[model samples]
Target: MTTRFYRRTASVLLAAALAFNCAASFAYAYSAPNESDLDNHQTYRNHDGETVHSPAHSRSGEAPDGATARCRDGTWSFSRHRSGTCSRHGGVAAWR
Candidate 1:
């Protein structure tokens, strides 16, 4: 009975650890990219001459030019306004 208890405790601990790891991975995967991950030269200015968020991407590849945001669907946004940016593309994953 003692051996069975120990085995069950170990199994439970291992399962808990796996669950936590999976949750952490999922959260990190969907979070916004860091500023350092972006290409600073990709930024553009609006009509008011104010600098806007530029297209940001990981090392996977380059985002399109004039892109102002990265969509959750893995697309780039060129919207001049932020109100509805990426509304149709599963919402904005990260504002560029």
Candidate 2:
């Protein structure tokens, strides 16, 4: 009986170890690229003349430029060219 129990225990332990190793390998195989892949990226210039570097996996598109105009109520959304940007921000910017 003792020998049979030992055999069963050893077999169960071996099976568990194999299953864990297989699961780990499968997870690693399907994983996405790591941080080193992000080092290879592209840089773009926004309207504010600031350079913006993005990783490979980042969303490929343009984000808003720098400060357009801030309102007295602290409201400044995206507005290009700035023709009528100050009006939307409640008249000329005070630069506060």
Candidate 3:
């Protein structure tokens, strides 16, 4: 009787562990972005002179010529024909 009870308890615990691991793996996979979503998207400068693009948090593309500074967040920003330091979250400022 004792051996049977132990075996049942071990099996239950193992099943619970497997279930938890599967759930966690599924959650992680859902949270991560797939690479296929980023194809064919081109980064470009917005009307505000800041670089804006898709596929959230992607760091790609080069600034146009005469750009004095560059900034990046969800998108990239480039300053053309202007001299200053680019701010990631804000506007340009004098370089220190």
Order the candidates by TM-score, highest first: 1, 3, 2
lDDT of 3 by residue, 1-96 (tens): 699999999999999999998765521111222334433344446444554332232333443222333343333222332323344435443211
How many residue pairs clash in each candidate at the backbone level? 2, 0, 0
RMSD of 1: 11.0
Clashing pairs in 3: none
Candidate-wise lDDT, in order? 0.62, 0.42, 0.40
TM-score of each: 0.37, 0.30, 0.31
lDDT of 1: 0.62
Model 3 regions more than 4 Å off: 29-96
lDDT of 2 by residue, 1-96 (tens): 699999999999999999998765521111232333342344444455544332232132222133333444444322333334445335544331
TM-score of decoy 1: 0.37
**Clashes in model 1: which pairs?**
53-96, 54-96
Which 10 consecutive positions of candidate 3 have the poorest summed lDDT?
Answer: 26-35
Best by the lDDT measure: 1
Residue-by-residue lDDT tens digits, candidate 1, 1-96: 699999999999999999998765521112333455455435556554655554444454666545567889776666666666677678898875
Candidate 2 Cα misplacement greater than 4 A, ranges: 29-96
The candidate with the higher TM-score, 1 or 2, is 1
